[model samples]
Target: MTVPANVAAALPQYDLGAEIGRGGMGVVYAAVHRPLGRAVAVKRLPGVPASDERMSARFAHEARLLARLDHPHIVPVYDYVQDRGEHLLVMEKLDGGTVWSKFTGSGVTPAWSCAFGLAMLSGLHAAHEAGVLHLDVKPKNLLFTAGGVLKVADFGISQVVSEGATLGTHGGQVLGTPAYLSPEQALGNPLSPAADVYGAATVLYELLSGRLPFDGGGGALAMIQRHVHHQPRPLVEVPEPLARVIMRGIERDPRARYRNAETFAVDLAGAAAGVFGRDWLLRLGAPIHLSPQVAAATTRPTATPPVVRETLDIPVRATLAEAGTTPVRLGAETLVPAARVLAPPAPARWFALAAALAAAAMIAVPLATPGRDLPVHSADLSKPVTLGLGDPTTAHLTLTAAGITLADVPATAPDPADPNPAAAGPTSPLTFELPGASRWIVGGAAVATVTADGKSADYSLQPVTHPLVSIMGAGSAVLLLFALAYLESVLRSVRRRRAGTGAVVVAAPLGFGLGVAVWLLASVLLRHAPDLWPALVCGALGAAAAVCTVVAARRSALR
Candidate 1:
């Protein structure tokens, strides 16, 4: 197909620098927004048959969908315009390439693959929450920026779910990439969130292993059949945690997969947190199977040891049998020839000196010293309290206490003076302030103990004091200073090792010392100032630490 002249004219405004990518649906160009001084990606959809109104409508629908989606991990659609019977969608131009490119070429690392998968899952979850589904989700649609932010792009085949609206049916459409299609989508069933979940898993699998789960020379139909009938090869080589997550995600039955993108993200997060085996399976609400593969993976032979099972732990035993050999069951306590052994901690006597010193410190420290009690007294109800309920009809409360204070109270209270006080019971635990006292008083304490009739039965309120909270805050500052110093020393050593002894190492010590000084100054201010000044001081110190660390790291990297 020849490039339309009118489309060519619209391209100049975008300062069409070069054609970056092209697909059956559209042609993406690298363009410069000259006036705004920024680069952008301009995707222009070519004119299709006017007879096929369904295709035209779907294309327009995609433009609308892209406009509505505004998320950090989603490619932002800047402007959508039509020129010369062609539609153009301008988007934020990212310098880095697509996940597809990485998957096909030098495969991404496990950490990066997991990270990218998690980010894409987050974006998909956001779209799902907004009642939109990217019908076609694949590696090609995932992009990476120069700053390492992963973005989901190309919502060309997305479907918007609205109240009382049926699924897209024009031209008998079955929209999705075949390799990543959910079983329902492959079978041309009405779509749901599970479709996206399946597609995401396929993309994740590709990202991790640089290969698709199913591939055949028999073409798209064959691949679809495989998706519908055949089980995917178990992701045994991949990390067990990730493998388990992917397996669940690509389950043959849509119902067996994650219910939604959010749930999938939660499982992915668990996998990333290194939870595996039966424990992780239980967390995922899946049944556990003691498979031979699992046993082999967990067990390894060592020269110096015969394996011994830990107390209350189950040991998996297996033996290679000859063609006619009979199987035998071994007792739980029976030690096999080549079993792996686990050991318990050494006796407490080994650390006797350390324990004695710790005991001495505990004894020397004063448990408690009599200090002025920060009295928390209840309201003096003897006087005309004149409690005013904000909404009297709703039975709102107005507590007028003297010395007692309420922490973490709701903003509005129900009307306590309501004729129908039953409504207030639900919205009880209201908090109010004293007329001239410094402390805030809480209402509805009686409701917690008894009903409005005030009969104490089974309720308890304990006073919580954190005298060590401030002390810990101070200790944190000191630890931070020491950490910085230690980090500087490590960096210095690293530089000396890598670039030789004479290499310049100036920023580390300087940054660490400056951080320590700022922390000390902030601590002093915190001790002197009243109110929430301590919190502010801590925040300032934290910000300073972050800035210093970043700057120092950048400088060191440059060196």
Candidate 2:
């Protein structure tokens, strides 16, 4: 098919600099929008179609569908026009290539593939919510941006399969790429959101495994037949959880598959997060029922009852493989155990216990002989300690109190430029002074072999508290004020509903008023009482007002 003359002329607005891509339906050009000062993609529809009316209508419908959708992961429709009687769509041009390109080459990592799937699901969910079905969803329609954002593009072949649309199937008019088409779509059954779910799964499978589920040298018809009847090979090469999710998504029966893109997204996310498990159903609070097949798979063989052992107090369920040829013996009767056995204490716990023991030994050994004092040493503080206002950095020092006079406690150099260094230091024979010390205590060394007569104790230093009530109080006040305003708006909405007013008309002003009030209060507080104290006062006032309003509203509702 030749490009339409008018479409060619309209392409200049987009600055169609170079022809970049071509497909069965149209050619995509690298274009620049002069006024917007940004590069864009221009897709020009086929000028002449063998089936003129149907194809043109479909193209126009797709453009309209793209215009209605506004989502981050979807290619934004910038402009659409017919110049010289030819159709063209100007869209956000992505620098990175298509998913197909990546898959056929050095395939993306599993993390990237998962991210791509999520982006596609998010875009598809938005489109589905807006009552549009992307009839053509394949790797070619998914684009990667230079900034690493994934976008779903090519809505030109999308069908408005929402409520109040035409309901007949176009026989022998399969719309999507054959390898990714759902069984229902391949059979020419009426399309629904599940079809998209199936296609998304196929794309995800291809991304992880680097191969399509079905391919044929014969023709499109052969591929469609395989999609309808044949079960694709299990994606065993991919991670188990991901493979399971894809298999479930591409289930032959539409009813057995995810009901919508949102469900698919949730399942895919679970798989990617490594949370996919049989217990997920239990976690979701779903009813537990074993199908006959599962029940049979788990059934244990009947054998002579084993003798009970005294040491084994609990009956342990063992797998068939672990059961071995001999019947395993159980212990004497005991209380039914909890559903889940508690895991053994972790290595961290053992390490913590050892640390505690060491600490206890350090303390107990030195104090066992109270009169014989230990020498303590100070920490090296020559290196600058980095700390925030409320944060503290501590250093340990040890000195022997046995030889040193009680009055000759080790003196610490004052923090330069700070007059209140005494407040930060310790005030005892064993503990020395350090500026900005919240608390200080002398403790024995972790090793106990050293004698207490000259062994020094370690001291831990922390930051002193600097109270600033106004900041915290003010924040609370602002939050309380907003809460009150939100409540007022909600009450107004309920009143309007009760009075038989439409939701939109009543909600608009209430919502606007609430938002404006919040902004105004926030701005006032920020400008005047930037400190904690003033903010605290405001918070108290807001809370009081909110409580009063609630009381008044309750009285009004009662009346």
Candidate 3:
């Protein structure tokens, strides 16, 4: 798409060149600062209507917050522009390609991957400390300078988590890429620093193993489900200690994972030193900056002789065809384990419980309690007419034969400077048109539809979402979660050769109380929503609680 006229006019100082990148967030262009004779990248956000004060404020706030980050491994923002109808961020430009382009096929060493992870995690930590989250962390966002130094770029989707609010997501849609999503993110639950660490771990895993942890054949939703329910495939031909560090970062439960990026970096450094020697980073010759704690951890001397391995044949992208019995050596004299033994499969009992819960939800959802019909409302379309007037949560729609539009009511009074008072009213601040035969908005799980013909319209709310469904779904999910948690505890006890009778005794009442509490909470919060939202919220919470408890129990068991 061509740049809008306003966007082009907004950046007078920069000579805009060819488009360098484009994605859902916005478009990026290569530009040169006319005064400084330096190249920079300009990211242009889509135009916000003049009336959209909320969005305008949000855009300006986020842009300024991102510009404050000044770490060596982070791409520095030079300036931010908010013109008549455009938003642009100007940042320093690097000529070297992305990390994906650099190491996709070439055989790079474990030392190299470790060094890369250190730098990437350090950058991520800096952002975290500054209350910014690089929600979208992937190889494509890892850019290299001409000198081969890696810098984390593209904070396009990064959210400023200040106080307790963020703009990471719009509506209910997921924001980050599907492949790198943490379990909490995949479930649309509240996010924490662990999410970025998960992304970093996924990247490190792919760089070393040449495949994603959950690289099954599927679309985005399927991939998300896998991350929620499946254990990652064991790392192969990687040093045992390094693999453990990576695995902990990618844990399904966010709490079980690294709490912050620096902790992950420290663990990674120690693991790298154990496998590659204390001076591994120095030997790799990569400009990886580590914190003092991490540097101190890395200084712990290794018993093994220092080995610097570099070879064109070292598989940077290990594939199925490369799987063999040959031991992966670090250098001429160093040796480590050939592969990590496969982790035992998940207990069958847990799978049975999950499958049963899945079956029950599938059967009950289609049979949700029917909705009560609200009074049928009519609108006179000749003048601007508001729909769903009393209920402010739903969108105010401007219906037309072409489609429907989401509009806000004009701020109470007319503009005094207008030529004609009749046409003096302002348009909705958040207005967008969609072309279709019928346009519908969902509240909870129920759909509200307004049909227009020429000048008049009629609308009704469908009864798809009801309190009964919410209670049923929420109660079931909570029970399931608690049941799994109890089972995990019992399983852990059994593995340790203990009786575990306490878990069995407390499971029923604990599950029942938790389920009832969740059901009541959901009923109160989603009373008006009346559709799918109650169940969805409860399910996301239940899944999060269940996974955290189970994972924690399992880890405690191992200990």
Candidate 4:
């Protein structure tokens, strides 16, 4: 927290106090303007020495950029200082601390999270419109005002996107927090507004779910790889509509993500209204500021109908015997305000039921279909026992007093173009001698059971497809297709910006699809007709994944 003597000595007009924070950019110190008696945060650019011309240019660029961004949610710069070998940026001091410091994984409510997002996004959109991208939009950069209004800070690593030029990266390395970097940003590709959108979405995700979208277990490199190649584990406990918005914002492909921060903010406001209520913003009671566009979004008709039932006026018939109050009630009786009931519209209710049924079917089909076992056929090994009846047989099993011998047969015919067709085959068949073995597995399944005498064996032929396994396999294919359809639906629905959807739309079907695939593969390999447990496992995974995805999405979406 200590500043260099020269840095303190350079700023004679202000009193530099203790260090507030430090990062790769520079160290920030609390200060007070002597003349104005105004508190401010002075960031000393020790990393950018006055001797380094390129660094100095970048420092000057940051000052100019910060000065231009005069929005309410962005930290406003007061002065830039360059004296001797030291460079510094002075800005308004926000004493309420940062989101990371106070609310990392705090599991804040949806309305609160969305309100924070609105303020952050409003500022980001303003910056974006001015051709600046805050590449490092992480929780730490989100500082709250004393009134609890969130403001975006630290444009040190921000890039100014102008005509065909970008300002941030140096030496092929992008500067930003790895956990929140967009896929393209992680890959050092040219960035767009979508990158900031991705970062902001990640911040909101953390605020709601109390976790980063990608874990930084393996360090920055691993996180970057995950950002580029992996989908965010679906949010848990988050509402589907809000989750969809976040998902779209953090999509791997920039083209697939939200176009700008303002658009994202509007969608978030709309989603907040659907999940919490039309007066969600009013109810939030958090002193977060909202731009006009975002505030307008709250009144827009949500894609989904209101989830909670409208307040109903029910008439109460008061009887002289039942009423504890005075029995003077007469005429139309009393119409009183009952307890507020929360129920979805009838159509929404039915749709939820249908989704539940579909998810159940996905799990049930795999468990219910008990595949038929392959019949054990006795084979006399005295004569060569062919394993498969085909033009080119699977293998030959020979049981002798010495041991059991299995020889592979060529699966392909000799090339007619070869001058020596006979020589094209292997000099000797590939053979394996299993000494004193009572069972043999082929192609990942136990296909043959040998007798103790070793002269005869009970063998299930290779490629013996069980009708049930085939059915399950075929069903798996269907589930896969269905999952694809669901994914498409997710994308389409997100584009339409609908709200009030449960987690089933995206997470449930996708999980069911994965379960179907696992069940089919495991069932086919195990080949035990009665052991249908794999189906149950499949179902369990599907259910658990649905729950996990739902939970994750829910917590992340609306909290």
lDDT of each: 0.53, 0.53, 0.62, 0.63
Give the winner by TM-score. 3
Q: Please report how far candidate 1 places residue 423 from its true position, in Å.
A: 99
Q: For model 4, how many clashes?
A: 16
Per-prediction TM-score to the true structure, in the order listed: 0.47, 0.47, 0.55, 0.54
- Cα lDDT of model 1 by residue, 1-559, tens digit: 3445665686666566667777546788877887898899888775552235666666777687778887778889888876556788889998888876665444455545656676787788778777788877898889878876778887766776553223343334345666888787776666778888999998887655444677533445667789999999766435566678898999989889999876776667556445233232334331112223332322322123222312212222212222333533333122221211111123323334333443233222212212122223334322222232232233322221112232222224445587866546543443333233212122212111222222222222211222123332344456656655754664554332222222223433433344333433333322211123333333344334433333333344323
RMSD in angstroms, all models? 29.9, 26.7, 24.3, 18.0
Question: Which ranges of candidate 1 are over 4 A from the true structure?
Answer: 1-3, 49-51, 163-174, 275-559
- Which is the better candidate, 2 or 4, if ranked by TM-score? 4
What TM-score would candidate 4 get against the native?
0.54
In model 3, which regions exceed 4 Å deviation? 1-3, 47-56, 165-168, 301-313, 318-559
- List, residue by residue over 1-559, the lDDT tens digit for candidate 2: 4444565676665455677777556787777877778998788776564147777776777687788788888899988776565777788889888876665544455555655776788788788888888767888898878965778888765667664333223433455777788888776677788888999998887665545666443345677788899888786534565668799888889898989887777666666444223233334331212223322322221122223223222222211111123333222112121111121223334433443443343223322322223232224222222211211123233222212211212333345676766535433122234232211211111111111223433322111221112222244345546654665665564432221123224333433333333332343322221123322333333333333333333334322
TM-score of 3: 0.55
Q: Per-residue alpha-carbon lDDT of model 3 for 1-559, expressed as tens digits? A: 5666776798888788888887656688888999999999998775432235765676677789878888999999999998867778898898888877655545456678878888999999999999988888998899988888899998877766664443255534467777788888767667778889999999998777666788644345677788899999886547567778899999999899999999998888887787777776777788877789988877664344233334322656433322333454432222222222122135445644663564344334424533335454332222333442222222344332112333223222334675764333232222223322222332222223432222222344222443343433445456656655675665555444242334434443444344334543333334322434434544444443444344334434433
lDDT of 2 at 442: 13
lDDT of candidate 3 at residue 463, scale 0 to 100: 24
* lDDT for residue 341 in candidate 2, whole number 0-100: 17
Better of 2 and 4 by lDDT: 4
Model 2: weakest 10-residue lDDT segment is: 442-451
Error of 3 at 286 (Å): 0.8
